[model samples]
Target: MCQRGIKVTHVSKGSSSTKIQRFIPLANGLTDNMKSFAVFLLVLRYLSVSHGCTCMEGPQQFPAVQIDAGQGNVVMTDGNNYAYFLLGSQWYKMGSLNLKHVSVGPAGIWGVDLNNRVYKYVAGSFVFANGESLQQVDAGGDGQVVGVTDTSTIHCLKSTIASDYRKQSTLSWTTITGGLMYFSCSSKYGCWGVNSLQNIYFTRVTPSTCGISGWIQVDGLAVMVEIGTDGSVFVVTRGGEVFQRQGIDSSTPQGTSWTKIPMPSRISHVSYDRGNLWVVTDYGTILKCLY
Candidate 1:
């Protein structure tokens, strides 16, 4: 039958036309082997000669809670099992990722990538996967969507349902004069932007209370910053000094307070996950905040 232009070769003559099935790419990137009757085919056009694709062979799993993808990776979960993966440009099923996002959520539900692309799993549905360039493209959900662009702009897309994802509240913010991966937003009130100067700055962005304010330089070259749910800012700087800021009426590092997490080392990324905080050290060590 002519299904979406692709010929659906009847694998079974006895199979009814109404029962005819077509191979539709998995929307959440999962191999059929993990479940039962599914297949995930990958086509790498660019990184094939460079960073080869790493395929995972296993069963579909769920997460304990939820997960957030970073730049170019995808997160998958079966409600109790969690998996994160970074595929160059190919396709992968559930439980095939490179890093873990214990901070954003459990380890599943949804995921972010290096390019800031996010996706959700819709079982039994065929979905076309997008490249990392699709960041800030679209997510099929409501709620607040935080999008980051490669052009040093942090955009906030907020809706409120699981299906009304097309109507996003997009607010773009430019980074400081320094080059950075752009700014990271919080669903709370504002977002923090890391500038090209390797410094950290964030301004209020809420609607009623959020006015068009300029950047507030926090410090020099923070390794990473995670805004808490209570409007407090936790910033990690060059020397592993963990600084916390309370409100906008503070000068930062001093206006609020500065307390270093006694890790005795520097870290690459500090993530908050599963009620605890995890930090990846510069030497590839994963350290947890002693809270």
Candidate 2:
């Protein structure tokens, strides 16, 4: 049987009240778990169009130190430095490699271990990437990849090596001006990063040549930055608060202003790709948000 006219109120800061009406189907032999999942989907749909965005509890409960999502694939690293990949709703451990940060994009899957060692996924295992040490790495660009060394030195992967990194004899990196503690690049709008002081910066990157111009400081403070395939930008503050960049198009690559997204807990990191937003909380709890 289907229950009609279920009303849910939308109330959050800076937003007016709105009613979400949906038909919830309840039938015989409907397990409690299934019922809960059904409600979750309904709420997710409602929040997607609400003021900003609200992330609901997901099926995944694993504690992740960092998370990345691309296309429909998700990857993350635990506090113990172990890597895991998500297939459907289950997470599978990826070999025995320990990675502090991981990224997936058009270039492929790349990560850096605790020692800042670079590695690439190949043959179901993470192989050593012949490149300089990088504390953090991102491969979200079309063929553009960028990373930050322990000294905060920024580096961009050479286009030639990025195209055929697997078959390349040696990987090369071009050092970019300015230092950053965190960086993320997008195929549509170039790159954005945060310095040690938490100052946000953006630059137009030449993905085809792996070249970047002078850094332009953006107003605001962020501990981390992530870019979506559609040029959507997101950032996590030191207080675990999250914000999304609005009005980002060809004319306004940097966007207009920040729109706060409601969260259940303090978030440490976030990655947005396709239509899914993956968040890692301060305690390592991972959440997948549909926005």
Candidate 3:
């Protein structure tokens, strides 16, 4: 048997009244072991609540056909072939460029031209980074760029310039693999990709082999996957459903169980940074997702 005491204080008219004390007895079925387990679970719940990720909905009237966030900046490409970047809350036009996909990260802004060549935005102009052409490109912090070729081969830019954003001559391309349709990377949590069959794969970024390895299968199907700086993962399905999971960890590298996020419209693209989640609907409506 166990008894726990709790004190309740009451006040009347801003004056202290009486202090009531109560003792609650534990249930007969609860043994000392059960009590200890319950206490452990309570501690875990409190920790998760205090340190877990949070999300909220943001502006609904953002002007862009597609949007991405990284490196304390939000970038969007409008329908007019114009690229706009957001510093703080204001949008600045970065001029016109023929880019089908654009991504911003600590490495700066990267775009893929109609011819599939990769270009890095520098000094108000897009400079060619590498000769290898790709169909899609995603930039990550620490000057990492990953892309998929027209033949579905995955390629990553091997940088010789280190952190220098100006020198494009120091960039070269290396093929990671083939048969991947989409890819995204987080400097903190490596990179993730989805193949033509909607299969997911992950490669850890480390000093060994530039973090490229044979594709490891992970559960879930996604048309797009975006990773936050904190390693939070968000995925958009072909059926327009948005789901999220924590990043790779010792217990669950494939991530925690997926949770469906409610949205007002069908999501066509998704991007996450820190705790903020952004989605663009099929109708070109942009919204910040709150969880």
Candidate 4:
């Protein structure tokens, strides 16, 4: 027996879980032969592994301007100099630091204050992470942090503390060559950034360096880009549309194409993890897309 075309089945609302199944047919364009059988099997396997995922709305809303998610936590700044962290579906006010941007990773959380000073969250308080002022900061699950200055100069935080040492020391900041307006990194996928021109760039993590390559222009204008711990990529366009990459693997370093995820019309920021996607609207509504 042979199927004829691709068919997708999706469940209606009110279900606890949404299940999607994709089927491919071989009868329409192929002759009745063994070759068609083999092709059909391969197509079935591919479709099963790569079905499109969708987003689900979250419970709470906030006046957030920036958001980040890590293994066990999510954090965001409320644009009024206050920050909040989500704990098991409930959001709690962390403090009033007047931060411009914030990020969370496996090691901890990092943020830049209104004056461009970078700080690390330790033991429920913000501690100065580096001396030099930065315009923005981002972190990775492996304790890697990177920042950019007002002049677009790039800097990375290098830990002087030993792995076995219990006491921690302030991280040393070093400047890199490239200039960027926004920067993000994934412990597994290296780093990515957008320059002043809104052009996107990617770098692979290597033993010696963060192998930064040249910038590649993508379709549509992106205001922000975020990478998940597993290398999943998401971007929010200036027009308030959210787009995600077709795959989460690091093999596609340049990310040639994207599929627009159906979301609110005024999304301003986005973050991703292994299980869910989070976004903030221009009016400060926080929503999550669960797969």
* Residue-wise C-alpha lDDT for candidate 2, range 1-291, written one tens digit per residue: 001222345567533323222234342356665555444444544443234343555545445689887766788888788888888878788889889999988777889998999988876888888768999999888777889998999988865577576642557788888999999987788789999999999887787676777788888899999998888899999999888887788887888888777765578999998777888876566666665
- Model 4 quality (TM-score): 0.74
State in Å the error of residue 82, model 1: 10
Stretches of model 3 off by over 4 angstroms after superposition: 1-63, 159-162, 165-170, 207-209
> Where does model 2 exceed 4 Å of error?
1-54, 59-61, 167-169
Q: What is the C-alpha lDDT of each candidate?
A: 0.38, 0.77, 0.65, 0.65
- TM-scores of all candidate predictions against the true structure: 0.47, 0.81, 0.73, 0.74
Give the Å shift of residue 270 in candidate 2: 0.4
**What is the C-alpha lDDT profile of model 1 across 60-174, one tens digit per residue?**
2222122223322333322333343325433244543322222222111334444344443435222222322223322211234343456645544333322332222333322
| Candidate 3 lDDT, 106-178, residue by residue in tens | 6678888778877888888888776678888887644667789877887776543424657576465666755
Which window of 10 residues has the lowest lDDT sum in candidate 2? 1-10
Candidate 3, pairs of clashing residues:
55-290, 55-291, 56-290
Considering lDDT, which of the candidate structures 1 and 4 is the better prediction for this target?
Answer: 4
Deviating ranges (above 4 Å) for candidate 1:
1-94, 97-117, 121-142, 161-163, 166-182, 207-214, 239-241, 246-255, 273-275
Q: Between prediction 1 and prediction 2, which has the larger lDDT?
A: 2
